[model samples]
Each structure stands twice: as C-alpha cells, then as structure tokens.
Target chain A: MPGFFKNKVFWSGVMALVATLILINMTSSERENITLLERILRDTYAPLQSRVTEMRDYLSGPRSIFIQKQELSERIAELEEEIARLNLSNQILRENEEEIKRLRSIINFRDNNLDKYELLAARVIARSPNNWFQSIIIDKGSIDGIEKNMPVITSKGLVGRVGSISQHTAQVNLITDREIAVGATLQRSRETSGVVEGMVEGNLLKMINIPYYASVKPNDIVITSGLSEVFPKGIDIGVIYQVTEEPNGLLLSATVVPTVNFSKLEEVMVITDFWPVSEETEAELPALAEE
Target chain B: MCYLIHFLLPFLAVFLQSTVFGFYSIKGTLPDLVLVFVICFSIVNGAGKGTVYGFLCGMLEDLYLGRFIGINAIAKALTGYITGRLQKGFFRENIIVGATAVALGTLLNAAVLLVLSRIAFPSFHIDEQFVQGVLYQFAYNIILAAPLYGWYYRSSRIGLLKLPGEK
Candidate 1:
C-alpha cells in the first residue's frame, strides 16, 4: 500500500481527481447561499482586517518623527504667516459683506423668479484603488439620502454619477467610465446635443456626435444637456481641448479635459432636489405633445 | 511549530512588502515572498508537509486578493510538490542552495501565474507589459530572498539548519 501511494504518477492522478471533484462541488452549489457566505466572510473579515492594518500601522509608528516634527514646525510658521494675510482678508470680507447684502437683495429677486435645485454637501473618506479604471468611494450613502444615478459634482464642475449605494457608503462611477454616457452641449454656441465618452488613459473625456454645423472652437465650455434626467442643465463638464471634423462630414469629435481632478477629489456635492422623470411623467409627455 | 512559523512569516513578509518595502505593483505582478517562504518550507520540511503548507498559504492569499478563487491554491500546491520532489534529488540544505532554489522557484511561480491568468481571463489581456512587470517582480523577490532565508535559518535553526558543528 505504501509503495503504491509512493508512486509519483499514482499520487498525481489521485490529487487531480480530488481537485476536479472539489471544483465541481463548489460550482454546483446553490449560488445565493454561496453569495451569502461570501458576504458574511467579507463583513466578518473586513473589520478584523482593518483592525489588523491599524495595529500594524501603530506598530510601525514614528519612524520619521524628528523629520516630521521639523516639517510640522515649518508648517506652523507658514500657517502663522497665513494668519496675518487672513486677518487682512477678514477686514476685506467685512467690507464685502455690505456689498454682498446689496447684491443679495438683487439676487433674491432674481432667485425668486428662477427655478432652484437643492444641493447637499458630502465629504469623501476614501477613493478606490488607483488601478480600478473609473470608480470613487464617498462617505455618504443611502442613509444620507444618496441614491443610485445621483449626479456628483464639485465647486469646479461635474464629477460623476453614483453607481452603487450601501447603507453607509456609495460608489461613484466617474465620467471616465466607458459605460457612462452623458448628454452635453457646447456652452458658447448652445449646440443642443453631444455624447460624452470616457477615454482609456490619463483621465481624458471625448464629446462625440456634435453637429459639424455648430461652430466649436478650442476652449469652448461643455455643459450637461439635462436630456438624460441624471444631471441638471448648465453644470460644467469640461473645456474642449481638440476638435476634429469626422470623415462622415456630419458629426465632429472633441477631446475634453474634465474640470474636477478625479485624482485629488476630497469633497463633492450631491444634487438631491432634482426629481427624476417618472413613468407618470413619461405617460404625460404624449398628452402634452398632443396639446 | 513549523506550521505556526509558516503562517506568521508569510503574513509578516506580505505586510512588510506592501507597507515598508512599497513593492506592490499593478495587476498580478507583485513580489512573491510567499513563494519564497514555500520554497524554504519545502526544503526544510519534507514534501508532504510542504505541499500542505503551500496550499493553506495560497488559499489565504486568494482570500486576500479576492480573485480567481481556487487557481492560486492549485498552482502553489503543484509548485510545493515539485520543490519537495527536487529536495530528494539535490539535497543541499545550505544558504546558497536555498537562495538558488527560491530564485528558480520565483520564475516558475510567475510563469505558472501568467499561464493560468491567460487561460482563466482571456478577455482581461495580461500582455507583454504584464510579463515585463512580473520579470521586475521576479528580480525584486530574488534580491530579497537570500537575506530573508538567512534570517529564517538563523532564528529557527531547529528545522532549517543542520550544521555539522552543531551537535
């Protein structure tokens, strides 16, 4: 029996047979139950793994404390210098408050006449690994009134749309994802339709299907068209980098540099007030067309 | 005792490789200290124990990586078996022999990963760039293997080292 088991070919064949049986069993098992097992493992291990990571970090603490201390002292000096400048800015701000009050009276009158969209501020805690093509993780989630397909933006411009929402976290699929399609228009000439597509490298975006008749130039601002009901009209997407007339002679393509640097994103605003067009609204659209 | 060291050593090496060494890379290309550990384990322990340790370690790695759930488990088990078989033929249990074995084992591990990943994820395209990346990782792991094996041999001389002078 020992001699039979000791044969290399015999053992190899035995192992292969066992592995095949295990693989078959694993694959043929109930998928939902397997998914539940995976989720349970992930949930159980994630916190323990995070704690272990934290402990390891703590164990490797303060290797460069002396250098960091000097850096912190220099940073303090810089902050002290900035405090003086901020004091001057504070006085300027007081003077500007009076002017702002005057402007507010005018803006309040204008705002009352115009439609308004409510915005919510959310802080970003972590980003997905840099290797993942186009995804971001933000702190706010379904619990914070964030929903899938909500538009994420920054003070600078449009960032991306929310893709997944958990109770405490949300994943934003950036405008740079290949699957994400946004309706946009040229801000300068008011060209009504263009599709924004993500390029593969270097956080670049391209606006496709722009009409050749529309005069688009370099540096023309592109804004969302609000046709898809995902983003509101007039939110900035990017400035056009290059424009080329396609061989078809009907449509032009323009490469755009996104306004928000997806690499260094720290905070964003979730547009929560825009009611997405419902099935009822779709049903009423034909009636309105008849009218 | 050997099993506990096997568990702790690979975990420590991976943690340090990711954090202190900063040697993590894109895709499936990273310094494979676990492979080195398995090679050393197989050399010190016999083939049966080595194969078992390799399978368990590879399973842990698969769990951490969250992809191709059982592929590494199979590959590492095979590699462990081969290394253990080699131990019977060329049974020189010294630092130089261990280093050479690990270097060759690293190459074999990368080749196995490349072939398996290609077979498994055809659409994912692990191309020339990825192969080059693995070569770079191979060089890095080879450079670190000697000193790491030396340290293990010194600290855990019970199973790892059987010097003529030592009783």
Candidate 2:
C-alpha cells in the first residue's frame, strides 16, 4: 500500500486535527475584559446592529397593539395606506407620537426613581447569538461610564450585570444565565435567605439552599440581600413560583419568575453607583445619649 | 461583488440571529440561522470548500459569542463536510432535499456542540428541559430551512455568489 503520509485524505485529516487543536487552544474563558481588536470590532458592528433594531422596531411598529388587533390589522393597514397617500406627514406624525410615548415612559421611570440609583439610560441593541449565553448588547459602553460588572436594571426589576466592554457597546449578561448567582432574600420576611441562580429549565430562576424549616410560599417576592458585591440590596429579583425539596432532602429550593419581561425589554438603566443614603445627605446620629 | 456576497450572507444571518431575533426569543432560544446558512451554502458548493467555509464561519461565530471556542467550529465543520458530501447524490434543487439536509445537519451540529459543551463545562445540566430546548431549536431550523435555501438557490442560479472555481 501507498505510504500514509502521501495520501491526500490522510493529510487533510491531519491538517483538520491540527487546525482544531489550534482553535481549541485559542479558546477563552469568562474574561475580565476584551482586547483592543475585540473592542474595535464591537464598536464597528454596534451601529449596524443598532440600525437593524431601529428598522425592525419601525417596521414592526408598536408590537403589542398590532399583535392584539391582528384581526383588524388588515383593515387598519388599508386605511393607513389611503391616509399615507392622502397625508404622508400625518402618518409620520402618528408613528413619532407612538415612539415618543414609549421613550417618555423610560425617561419617566428614571425620574421617578432618581433617588434609587444614578441611572444611565441605554437601549438594548442585540443579544447573545448562541443559545448557551443569555446576554444583551446595550448601546452604552465604557465611554458612557459603563464599567465591567456594573448592574443593569429596568423599572420592573434587576436585569443583569455588564460582561465585556467596548468603546460604544457593552454585553449585559442576563440573570437567566446558569453562571450568574445572586444572594437573595424573601422581601416580605427577610429572615429567609438563599442563593438565586439561573436554571437549565425555561425562563425561570431558582433560589436554593434554604433551611427546610423556613417559611416559603408561592407569590413571595425575592429581592437582592446585599450580600453580593455586584448587586446592591432590595433590588427586586422575582416572585417565588413553586417550592420544592432538593434531591438530598436537606435544603429547599423555589422556582422564581422574574419581574422584568425580558422578551419585550427595550430600554434599561445602567446603575453607575448607588449609596444606602442619597448623596444629598450624610450619615450621622445625633448626640441624644448625652441626656 | 460575488465574493462579497459570499462573505456577507453568513455575516448578515449572524447579525439577524443576534439582534432582532433576541427581542422576540421564545423560551430563550432562536433558530440556529448560521448553521442553516452553512449547510445551505455547502449544498451549493462541494465538500472541500464547504469544510473550509464552515470552519471560517464557525471561527467567526465563536469569536463573536462562544463561551468556548472550537465547539462550533468542530461541529459545523463536520456538518458542512457531511452535508456537502451527501448533497452530490440528491436532487438539491428540491427544497425537500435541502430541508432534509438541514434537519440532519442540525442534529449533527447539536450533537457535537452539546457533547463538547457538556464535556468541557460539566456545570451545565443536560436535563429534560435542555433536551427539549434542543428539539425546539431543531424544529425551528427545519421550519426555516426552506426559505434560506431557496434564497441561496436563486442567488446561485443568478450567478451572484459564484466563486472563481465553484462550477
């Protein structure tokens, strides 16, 4: 038989194996930060991603009402077409009004919770491409004071923490990823505490490692216990959906449904910093004990 | 123009997979559009080119969002090579043939990716829910395979992405 070294198929196989080895060796982990080249790539691609999102939103237009009124949508479309031909400006104005209402709500939420966080308003641009990682790309990045590991949130509740940074965009790993864990407590009865983590199941989170005797029930609200450095205290995590015993029968675990509807998430607030007391005031106790 | 189209097709699919679809993700999964694109692209081309294309595409995808590299590359390269090689005997002009290829390609891609992922990161539980998620994604790829294949077939017919030695 011909020598194996001279066989083209064998060489190709060898080459493939070598190539895979190189690629695997280059594989990275949960990096603390990205390289300059990655940043540039992210910066360049952010605008394209942003444009696609804008176009999708503009074309899809006020998704909830459109979806709900599916039966009337065809009639509405015909009517809108006629109106568009009659008065194009009127159509644009209507679209703008809808857009304005949505933006205003986001702005209003920040204003209402001005005391809670020094929030930076940002629009979600994209999400992790693969099924494995649950993350989103936000329009704001390092340039916007969005450092790595900063907590991102919405009016509904906590969203996730910033993962990687670019000049113009940052990847916010959603709370749904299996990797994330938060120190959580029962808001109604702070006596019960556990570690909240993402589940391999559906869009549900699991709070585990609670004492078997602790009182827990469905609809019980879970909030951050301030035990973790990344997230602060009292941020809403979710409501306890179902409670179950661990396989070991030692501790209890509960399924939690997140407050923020991640599917329809559009805008969010990146918490740059938060203090237990607002910056306008200082912590001090009056010398009342002297009496 | 032809080369640019060849490069841009998968990139556009990746962008779409990552961006607009993310907002409407049902049960936190979307169709593996890039995988679909690779299989379809391979069906048009042959094995040698398909394997190379698949590897490059997988590398690009891994670099973009992979938790660990080489998982997608290895999976996709195998998918591409097998699909491309198998396409020769079938009537690829038929959407059913292309769809079948995608269905099989999806299973193969899932096998490699998931097995490798589980081996590498044993922390991720491979339970009933995870299996269900894979099934959902596989079904989506099958449902979506036709339209993308049709686009590629039409584009190739029109000489849009014909490489220098493709024929």
Candidate 3:
C-alpha cells in the first residue's frame, strides 16, 4: 500500500537495506573500476577542489612571506659563512672534473653508458578523509602515463605506488599503509634479504624474514631488493631503527624509519621506466655485455 | 535555491576539510567538519530529510576518496536519522540538546566507520592513539555544534535565541 511505503520506519528500513548492499558490493570489488556516478562526481569535484586549494594557498602566501622575511636574514648570515668554503671546494671540483673528463676520454666512454631514469613529477591534490587508510590523490593519472603499481618517490626516498588511476588524478597508497609490502635488503650485506611491511599502529615500517645469523644492526641502510615485480632495485627505502630476534630463532625482524616524510609530502616523482634485475640476471649482465 | 544551498554547504565543508583544514591537524587527527554539518543539518530537519542529506554528503565524500563507496554514506545516514528522531523528544531550541546530539552522533558515526573498516580491511587494528583521536573528535564536534546550530537556526528562520522560560 502507498501508506505502508510512506511510513518513516518502512522507508528507513529500505534505505538501510540498500546501503548494506552497496557496502557489500563496494568492499568486494577491487576499487579500480569506479561506477559511472562516482567517476562523474570525481571528475566534477577534483577541479573545484584544486581551484579552492589554490585560492587558499594564494591567500596564505602573504602571511608566509612575512615570516620568511624574518627567517631569511638569519639564513643569509649562515650562507655568507658557507660561501667562502664553497668557493674553495668549487675550484677543487673543477680540477677533478677535468681529470675525470680526460680519464673518460681515454676509456672511450659512450653517451649511452649512463642509464637515464624516466620520471613524471606530480603534485599531491588530496588526502584520505579517514585515518585508517594512508593515501593521497596526485594530480597526474593515466593521461600522464601514471599507471597502477608505478613506483612513486620523493627526493628523500620511496613514498608508495600508484593505486587507482583516473583521467587527471591517481590514488597513491602510502608506504605506511598496511596493505603495501616492499622487498628490501641490508645495504651492508646484500645477501641479507627481507620484506618491509607497514604497521597498523603508527607511520612505521618493519623488516621481517631476515636471517637470524645476519649481522644486521641499527642504522643499517635498507634499499629495494629488486625482488618485487612492482618496484625496481637500488631505490632508497629507509634505515633500520632496531633489531629483534623472533621467537622461532630462525628469523629476525627490525623496525625501519622511512626516509620519506609522509606528513609533509607535496610533490613526488613517478618511475615510468626502470627494469628490475633478478639475482641470476645480475650475475649474467657482465657476460652478456661482453658479447 | 534552498535545495542548492543545502547541497553546496556540505560540499564546501568537505573541500575545506580535505584541503585547508588538513594542514592544521593535531597529531594527524583533524576535526571532521562533515560530521558536524550532518548533525546540525539533521537537528534542523526531520529524520527523513536528514537521512537524505546524510546519504548525499557521504556519497560525495566516498566519490572524492574513491574507496569504500557506501561506508560513509550508511554511517552518516544512520547518524542523521538517529539525531532527527531525538528532535521530537527534546526542545529543538535548546543549545544543550544540539550539542548533545552532535557529540553522540559523532561518536556513533566513528564507531560505525571503524567497524566497517575492520570488516573491509581485516588487518586494521585499533590502537590507543585511534581511540584517543575519536574521543578528541567527539569533543571537537561538541565545541563546533553551538555555533553551527545558531547559524542554521538563523538561516532556517526558526527563531534564533530561546528567551527566558522558553520551552
């Protein structure tokens, strides 16, 4: 009956049921394929949000400029002291460069000897509303060749990888997110391979599956192991803060302090082209080059 | 015009929270203005209308984030419905009633979100900081409720101030 449908309780129950179905469907999906409504809403709001953000920054610039002026005086004093030291170092560096050029010419170095990393720079546009998920939306997406699983990093270190890509934006899962797993190894001893995982509590990474006998200690640098299909090798990950022996005594775990500061992240670079070398391939690289 | 303002206010609040207010977060926990808006809106409107607003606001947020599409929508809608149901039992003109509704509604919304997050991401574990942050948000919502309710009341032409002996 129309009366029954009009009842507040009836409508409330119906809405509840509809919401439950949506939640179930959404959670089960991989979240990459957004619905038409979602896509439209995202496309519509992203530009508005960008404009508003720019306006806010523009408004705040004057106040920041005043503060920077006071700070700049002190910075200038320190820089003046450094200029004399740098002048001497600059001369020494010029002499070293000439010597290196002569040595390189003797070795007959080619232009292709240096491997150039192809990168795309992007600005962070937004952050997740909830603290449960650590992610940011970058202003670049498929239009900028930012595909899913592409490694994103800052000048400091690795941030995360691209998750879902839209036309003009992409979601980057932070390295601190629990869902992310990174292959890492101790820089001092490359044979000591481990897996770096994010903790649920704080912005922290923990390296596990380390050999119990490996001489791992605090302050050991950790780098990408190149074992992952997603990330390439030689990327700086973090440094070990502490080492703990697992109860099994067969493996050890260490807490890592990531080099990238997630809280202050603004701009990042996406690695578009990089080949990860496997252990066997690395061993055979010199032989193959010889032929 | 009223319908457009109703939709625009929440959208603007969400945008500000995501962009500007995000910079002023305390210990990585920012006060959720969207939650405050829903509670205030629900207090002004009835249960049915509040639920609709809640759904719309939550849906917009989910779209912006592009993850867990219906989670926020369902939680906010239920919070709005619950707050709206409280209107008939208490004096709507009372600031205490409005603030109480915001505190309780925000706590409920947070609980529902945490539960849904656990269900979706099984590895998520509640830490002490998370609990503390939720409590801080509850207090923050209460502090924001008074001013927001006054603004909504003035705009709705619902008689802004309750004089002495007003029921």
What's the CA error at residue A106 for candidate 3, in Å? Answer: 19
RMSD of 2: 10.1
lDDT of 3 by residue, A208-288 (tens): 999899989999999887777677776788999999999999999999999987766778999887655556876775565
In lDDT terms, how accurate is model 1? Answer: 0.65
Stretches of candidate 1 exceeding 4 Å from the true structure:
A1-291, B11-29, B46-48, B87-92, B154-167
How would you encode candidate 1's per-residue C-alpha lDDT over B1-167 as one tens digit per residue?
54466667656654444333331343323467777788777776657767777776666555433334555655666677777778776644467777787877776776665565555545344434445655666677677778877776665565534433433
CA shift of A116, model 2, Å: 4.9
- Chain A TM-score values, per prediction: 0.60, 0.71, 0.74
Error of 1 at B61 (Å): 1.5
Judged by lDDT relative to the true structure, which candidate is superior, 1 or 2?
2
Better of 1 and 3 by DockQ: 3
Tell me what fraction of the real C-alpha contacts between chains A and B each candidate also makes.
0.00, 0.55, 0.29
Listed for every candidate in order, the interface RMSD values in angstroms are 7.3, 2.4, 2.6
Ranked candidates, highest DockQ first: 2, 3, 1
DockQ: the better of candidates 2 and 3: 2
Q: Itemize residue pairs with steric clashes in candidate 1.
A: none
Q: For model 1, report DockQ.
A: 0.14
On a 0 to 100 scale, what is the lDDT of residue A137 in model 1? 54
Task: Using lDDT, rank the candidates from best to worst.
Answer: 2, 3, 1
